[model samples]
Target chain A: MERVLFKPLSQVAICGGTHGNELCGVYMLKELPRDRSGTFSLTTVLANPRAVDTCQRFTEKDLNRCFTDTLLSDLLTEDSPYEVRRAQELNALLGPKGSEATMDLVCDLHSTTSNMAICIITHLNDRVGQHLFKYMREKIRSAPVRLILLTSPLSEGYSLDCLGKHSCTIEVGPQPHGVLRADVYNQMREAVDRMLEWIESFNSGTVFEGGEVEGYSMVEKKDYPRDPETQELTAVIHPQLQDNDFCLLKPGDPVFMTFSGETIHYEGDELYPFFVNEGAYYEKNTAFVLGQKQSLLVPSISVEKEQ
Target chain B: MERVLFKPLSQVAICGGTHGNELCGVYMLKELPRDRSGTFSLTTVLANPRAVDTCQRFTEKDLNRCFTDTLLSDLLTEDSPYEVRRAQELNALLGPKGSEATMDLVCDLHSTTSNMAICIITHLNDRVGQHLFKYMREKIRSAPVRLILLTSPLSEGYSLDCLGKHSCTIEVGPQPHGVLRADVYNQMREAVDRMLEWIESFNSGTVFEGGEVEGYSMVEKKDYPRDPETQELTAVIHPQLQDNDFCLLKPGDPVFMTFSGETIHYEGDELYPFFVNEGAYYEKNTAFVLGQKQSLLVPSISVEKEQ
Candidate 1:
């Protein structure tokens, strides 16, 4: 197999607190106590200080959805949302978006209320990302780490990680908003440690042989059933389905339970559910997302020497 | 046993959304759909509309703490907090605290992030409350229902339930903020049903017998380890202690895990911990409250007729 070569990573950025109330990432970046003098120059940032100060998800709009190119170049005025202005400032610090000056890698830390374990969410079919993800899955044993490939292209990505030349998002959870769990935080730290280890080995001319790795590609999202008048959810994720992320959801499986004590079942083809009962998504109207499993034939990769 | 007598509950209020984000209570009150035409007149309330509208805990101050007489009587001015203003309105409708016009019973519904199943929180040693709690415990079978005797007297209580002549707080849990779980909501609904059933039986000249019931009484609260300079939490509830509410904590038992992976142990005498890893209490500077277990020797009670 031909090795996919790339120049050694020169600059890498890590950010947290994109949604502020996701405390695992917020604290990880704020209290990182290590001498990070490594082969790669590292930059750490708190993505949303205003929201983190009050432990709110965001002030005006979700900063995560503000990173798209269209929003990045939008005219800035006093009436602009707080996240829009902050996103521009962040773009200046770590990114210019699709430019040579962008950081070599950007790894954003996120947390969710769902019971999905550590998830590596990245753009699909990127050899560099797949190899790194394979390394992380093999190395981290503290939690069951899984992969999720975004269906959209990198150019259309809206997350903060999309700012880098090569990017990956490390989302760890089951921790509630505004509450930090020691195990969740430690799992994220361990994953980051493993990522850094892989980066150093790649930069030092070590060849990583990759064959096959399994990942989930997002198919569609399902919102909770709601009352037409109130727009409030009329049903809740069923107890049988709650916290059962990454499990195959089949047709006729119980999915929701209405307030009147009636069970609602899934009517679609077999697909795996993720992000079941995420608290933040309650307002977003999303109950869970269904994903289709796929096998990625990752290729061997090594660092390319500077010409 | 001598039958303790009281005038049958006349005006009853069941309130929810006091702490806005506790959805178990919020939805139960909003979606209560049954023939509630009974012996006792019932008034349902959605407390703190401003906060509930945005799915936040509160807008200006915790409404639960604003019911204190001092705050309720504080001169309503332009500078008063939103909750203080709301508290005054609530007092006028349901209470003139320490007066004859207050509702007969104000049973407020609440939910917690801790796994403290269905908890009946009430003022300690009130015969009427004890008998009703005993009745509910015997009737409800879906969830483990327990009792919590508030250490503070009703005169000094700050909760919304204090507005009633006789009040009880039904707190159910393990549900995250802004997220509703069907099981938790159903547990609360069952409790309210049992309470109404008790009320009807008591008003119909039925005698209730109670011997002893197990309950927990309040003790000191412990805060998470913090960095003195930054005031940011330095540790989180240990994996061993997370979700283990109502479990005993003894000297040398692991209580917290530092961000740097060190375990901190409890140093106090054996006590049960409740509200373990509660998300809202994180900002209140409380990790969990230690409780002392007690056995209440309750007396028989019956309705006191117009005499």
Candidate 2:
């Protein structure tokens, strides 16, 4: 692994409360060092104000899911939901998309009820995102910055970060929606601060030495047990697996428990569960998303543009 | 305290999901033996189906709060939101109000994000409610069914339980809204089953021996610390007081912790806090409510009509 300088970015946007009930990002973004930049412009946004007011995931539709190209193109529809219009407006503000984006870097903030530590979700090939992840892994002390790559099959064009090529999301949690836990709050704040420092260093053409990073690649999501007839939940996450997010779930592990005291075991291959039992994902039938570990030597980003 | 026989009721409704995301009630109600009729008629209703579909507290206004006379009376207004109309419809179905009600008992079920135990909230003078509370106290094994009396000044007429004088609430918690923990779910189901058995005994002219019950009375609610400039939350529940729900708080006990790490101490007389740091209460500025403990000897209800 070689240390190489990365090119300085001209402008970046830091966003929070995209899900509304997630308060850490909103709280942290408000206190960020907006004045610390002589090298680049920093724009902070509270993405969904109406949802935040009601302490909900979204107002009409999920703001995160409303950023699809089709939805953004149909922004003029009079019957469009609140989040559709918001996506179009945000796209215009930070992005025109692809190369025309005003934001050279986009850092969207989110929190989960999962015990994921300083999670950084981005495209697998995103160089800038990888650089940021490496910086946080080396810099942040409280917890490891776990990088999870969203593979090609997972639709990326429907999220705020998709508006820009050099974008990443900061996801930290185990904090319930609309509730602020001091431990998680501080962890999230530190994540944002470290991320900002990483951006600042990149903008200043500081070299980020390449290092080995341990992370997971998202596979697929699994739904909890539901009644075959009514489709309502028939079982709950087992007591053993309840708060064991990000832990390796091997075959035969107890996964769910029926009301009558029947325990259901995991019959699948070993996988790590993240975002276990997130309240926001209840409607989606998501008990948790499985991830597979990958050990990689992150390459340094060179400041020079290849001719 | 000597147990006396309570009058048999003709009909009862066990309701759940009033807040939609509270799953224990909805899940428990689904499996209840609705056909059993050796005693009173048992009707199970999932209160806010739309909110449950979306895994939120409500669509427009809180369904629980929408039961007020003004909203129920104004159900014909096109301006009335989903929950308002739902409230009016619910009142019409389970209630007509007071002594004219067809349903002898309306047990509204709820779950909180707070660490509240199996809580029974109702007017202290409601003798039947007190008897049920005493029954739960003696029967349920996990936690004591703590009673909280909503005095007249508290505006009880605004809630679903206010539909009839015989109505009472079964609130259990430490569970987040959308996520169902198996531990909490089982506890809630037990509470509901025990309640039904208590009702059946009353209906069968079975004498309930009077017994002493331990519970609390609501004193007042306290809001969390907010920034003077933005009115946004500036503090969180102190680590020491976070999960200490139903536990006594002395004058010098820390209740809140500022973002800057400052601890705010309780300054009032010794009172227990319930529903501490409930995520749903954030919008209402409710950090938690204060409760003073009370020990009461519940009297047996005689089935005989004295006239």
Candidate 3:
């Protein structure tokens, strides 16, 4: 039997295969060569090992969504052998109540169902998340990325969200079952390198001024269809927005109009489209800039001799 | 001469020998042991090294206060060949835009004029700060410690404050010139170890639950008193208060009336103290337990034909 032991080292967590089908993140982890570099004092772990083996979303529950304090504690205490054991193992490595080698960052890797490029999901208003996201965006500026979504608030019981305030989820685009794309792998590797570099810079007393993106925006409302039989909510997306398309609308502009046999009436600006294709929702990239209104600008004036 | 190359590594940072009389932190760093089990990824830098040799606060300006982005950036881009070159070296190790290996943590060690236990100054509502503070409290529970104060609302332009979020300022009590305290060194070493443990925990997917200590109150309210002749603000501390003392007043309580020579009168259900001790301003421990109100309990008759 393999001996279960705890080594006194800095830990690095990488979570992949949360969707059961996506493989890019997993492949990247498996392929990345571990070298002894003075970059990061790293201790890495692969969460949801069983899910990765079975190629299933989850066995009985979504492992990513089962990271609540109560659930994790209960799992740790229970006699049953489950994935919670992995979490307990991680905790042991973190040490007793007073041990100093605690977590600094948690990067959970994943892949979306849609064919979008790499994106990072994290909390809004988080300093580390914002800085890292800006750094990552600049690292991969020329990619077929749809949007870097901030989905922590929407999904409360997420693994990375529960780890630390600085934790983030990296989502690579759709990958064929059991196959990882080279582009996605390269991006993930680059991100990991960037993270290590950031840590090194911090320890060295050097300032790392991450790149400045445009800004951030929030997703106020999303349109969905209703089921005909049960009248329950169902998946639906209309007026699919293209990348970087800025939506311009004045106050009180009609946003949603009900269709009645060709009659298209106006509806109030309850859900105005400010910037279409604002990208995925994440904490740091939550806000995005909109086109400046011409009316709001003050007209330039010529100065007199007094000026 | 050495190559003077900028090597980006995770190493410790030591600063503040302004007064030739105060050098506890500097000595501690110089005497730190190199042999350890876990990885010590750090970049070591001696801020104001010249001051250390000269036994002075500064030659031109207070280096601690010169942490603005513009000033630092200028130092990085200037034409001078002295400290500017050092700044350039530090930046190269920190990495340029999109460079991997950024800084992970920074600790600006210093010694105060007054005698007190070690204290960590960091921003409130910051997860990293909370985690580090909690870990330290747990480790030093058996020590001869008075209390751990968390200084918040940090004024701008301090090195650690300007650090990439996960940074802290460790202040040690007054020590004789060029003297090293074993206790202080051990405490700092333990703190650094705990920091690494935190990073490991985070990397291994262990969630860091902050202590119930919600926040801290400022000890001093009035601005630093200026010297009569120099008219420059001088550091001053109020009288220390005992733990669980009666000097603190609840929120909205009159500050003048409580501090005046007159006796305090209370008309409400209960009056809670606010600022109590010399350095005590507010409650740093915010966690509390839920208790049942006395009015909620009732005696019930038995259901056996209850006559």
| Structure candidate 2, residue pairs in collision | A5-A303, B2-B210, B3-B209, B3-B210, B4-B300, B5-B301
Model 2 regions lying over 4 Å from their true place: A66-75, A100-102, A138-145, A153-157, A202-206, A227-230, A300-307, B1-5, B66-88, B100-102, B153-156, B202-206, B227-230, B300-307
State the lDDT at B198 in candidate 3: 57
> Model 1 segments beyond 4 Å from truth?
B33-35
Per-residue lDDT of A1-307 in model 2, one digit per residue for the tens?
6655444676888889899989888787777776773667888988998888877789889999877767878837778888989988898898866655457778888988776768898777677788788887778888767888876522346788777657789998878788887878878778777777777666666666676777788788999888789787878889888878778999999998987779999988899988888877867879988999987777777565434
Question: Per-model i-RMS in Å?
Answer: 1.2, 1.3, 31.5
Best by DockQ: 1
Scanning candidate 3 chain B in windows of ten residues, the lowest lDDT window is: B287-296
- Candidate 1, residue A12: the lDDT equals 85
Q: For residues A1-307, could you state the per-residue lDDT of candidate 3 as single tens digits?
A: 1212222114455555554435555555554456667634554555666766755445546566555555556634456445556555544553221234445566777754233456665555444555566666666664533233353442254463346435667765433233333344555666666666655554444444533343324445433233478532222111222222334433444322111112122233322233221212211122222322121111211112111
Candidate 1, residues B29-114, lDDT tens digits: the string is 86664356767888889998899998899999999998898998999999999999999999999998868999999999898889
- Candidate 2 lDDT, B1-307, residue by residue in tens: 5555444677788888898888888788878886785767888888999998877788888888876667777837678689888887888888865546647778998888787779888776777887787788888888757888876622346778776547779998788778888878877888888888888777766777766777788888999888888888888999899888988899999998888778999898898998898888888879999989988777867465324
By lDDT, who's the top model here? 1
Tens digit of per-residue lDDT, candidate 1, span A32-84: 64467768888888999999998899999999999999999999999999999
Give the whole-model CA lDDT for all candidates, comma-separated: 0.88, 0.80, 0.42
Give each model a TM-score. 0.98, 0.89, 0.36
